[model samples]
Target: MSATSKKILVVNRKSPYGGLRSREAIDTLLVASAYGLQVSALYLDDGVFQLIQSQQADQINSKNIARMISAFEMYDLKEVYVDASSMGKRGIQQQDFVIPVEILTTEQIKTLLHQQDQILSF
Candidate 1:
């Protein structure tokens, strides 16, 4: 920790295990949290599917990314957010997510980005 808490924002725009993007985003957040930084995770575009309940990665032989996401609480990293429009486009209601999350507009997301000491997008 520094003299002041550092705010780190991680943006995920891809589905988990679709490639490396979502994995890297989550790993970054975990590392930042381990260092005791204030961290937030934002899901946009296809990334919203990453938080969907009952994902079946086994069919694709992919690792269960949802389990990694569930570890956020253990790390005390709780500022999870999703894009409201994205969710609507995907037909994902609030109850569809495995975890409750703050839904924000694009403008709200921009405001959050501006508040962060660092921003990493994946």
Candidate 2:
């Protein structure tokens, strides 16, 4: 990683299965990190569902997002975050997810957004 690699924040605000946005967001994150960028991802709104355990994409003939999510750490994409309020609204807890994530309040998310050199919403 370069000492001055750009800090990129990728936001996922849509449901993972509705369309390809959520998956594309994760792909973007991986590519960015692979290029030596400091990449992070924030799951907001229905996007929180993307991290839930036991996703059955096979039933729908789609790729397994949950499995891909678990690979984030291996890709060196360590700054994954979930919105606290969104999780509460959906009745999801940290233990409900397949991988570890830092839960952030909305205000904290805003602060994080401001700190990023680039922001991309998927």
Candidate 3:
């Protein structure tokens, strides 16, 4: 990584398809990666739904964020994460998520936040 490569954490806290925040966050992730920053996404609250599988956005006439997420690897935007507490509260199993996510405990989330050089919350 270059010295200019910042460790950024993009936090998503809104519901998927409810508004443009989720889409904006994903856009930021891709742009940051293209700029050579070390980017990761931390999904919490209703944002976890953004990772759920088999979303039919066409029916709602919305761009499919789920499909966008599956392409994160191609953009070199890895290290996707989720809050364990959020998942449990929503009754979402790890396998239920469309993309692979590193489910983190509260303590781990704290540590991650501390380690990041920049935080962009959506």
Candidate 4:
């Protein structure tokens, strides 16, 4: 099937800073979704930090990505899934996220990833 006909999941695992992986993942998600792909985001490990509010990217000379993330809705992106285990490990609560998210258990995450037609990791 074509890309627009398939489900695409963007899996992000990098910290919001110290690298561009998180930014790249968001960029890719926006572009893919703009093309009419069925896109979703799964923030695992440090990736969950990408949704944290009041980030100090400027402290490190890195540009903020909050705006890009907030654009998910305009692009009609699917659900934003956060790993429950990861959040607990990092002491991050659902309220800590700038945008709303659906929490998923490890097993559920596995099933979700398994069901995706395309998996893009960063």
Candidate 5:
């Protein structure tokens, strides 16, 4: 992108089910990317659950977030990330996720946020 383009970061901190925040976060990322914005997504706490492979949203009568997440690459929405502490606390590994993500420590996430011109949390 150009130097004038703002770097946007979308932080997902909610569960995919029982709410719409997680899905909204993904939608935001896709929309931003479609507009040619520099976009990245960071999943923390329960939000990391969205990346779990083979989600069964049918049980909750909700749209499968995995399907939306799977379209990330097609939209050029790269730079997906997860917090290391959260992963350890929840006993989740990279293999447990639907797609490869760059794992970050709390400090690294802070640095990432600092580098962004905008941050949207859901």
Candidate 6:
């Protein structure tokens, strides 16, 4: 990696409306993309819920977070990953997500953590 290139890994470990962490994670990714950094988003634990299809935030009168996730590709962020076990636990399959995401095992996540230039969890 060049000095001007950044390998930023963002881990989203919470629900979108459960707290601010989910939104923050997406926001951070957007900012990183704007700066021309190589950004990767990892959905672990409850974070897998964020990618569930047909999320209706209008029931709670909140903004739709799923749409934000879908915009990642437009921003040139191609490295979206989700924990396989987490998705299974939440009854979410790969088909449940709008974006094509890499399903990762715990070992893979550990390896990615070591490979990243910066790791941010939210």
* lDDT of all predictions: 0.88, 0.90, 0.92, 0.89, 0.90, 0.89
Candidate 3: clashing residue pairs, number: 0
Give the per-residue lDDT of model 1 (tens digit) for 7-36. 888999998777988888889989888888
What's the CA error at residue 59 for candidate 1, in Å? 0.7
- By lDDT, the better pick of 1 and 6 is 6
Residue-level error in angstroms, candidate 6, position 19: 1.5
In candidate 1, stretches whose alpha carbon ends up further than 4 angstroms from where it belongs are 1-4
Cα-based RMSD of candidate 3: 1.5
The digit string of per-residue lDDT tens for model 5 on 1-122 reads: 57439998999988889588888898899988998899999999999999998799888788989888989999988799999999999998899888779999999999999999989999
Write one digit per residue (lDDT tens) for candidate 2, span 20-118. 998899899888887778899999999999999879999999998888888898898889999999999999999999888999998999999999888
Residue pair clashes in candidate 2 = none
Residues 21-102 of candidate 3: C-alpha lDDT, one tens digit per residue = 9999999998888888788999999999999987889999998899988889899777999999999999999998888899
- Candidate with top lDDT is 3
Q: How close to the true structure is residue 112 of candidate 3, measured as C-alpha lDDT? A: 98
Q: Write the per-residue lDDT of candidate 6 for residues 1-122, one digit (tens) a residue.
A: 68447688999999889978888899999988977888899999999989887899999998889998899988998999999899888888899897889999999989989989999999
Predicted structure 6: clash tally: 0
How much is 73 displaced in model 6, in angstroms?
Answer: 1.2
At residue 92, give the lDDT of candidate 2: 93
**Residue-wise lDDT of candidate 4 within 1-122, one digit each (tens)?**
87678988999998888588888999999998888888899999989889987788888888887657988888888589999999999999998888889999999999999999989999
Q: RMSD, each candidate, Å? A: 1.6, 1.8, 1.5, 1.0, 1.7, 1.2
TM-score of 5: 0.94
The pairs that clash in candidate 6 are none
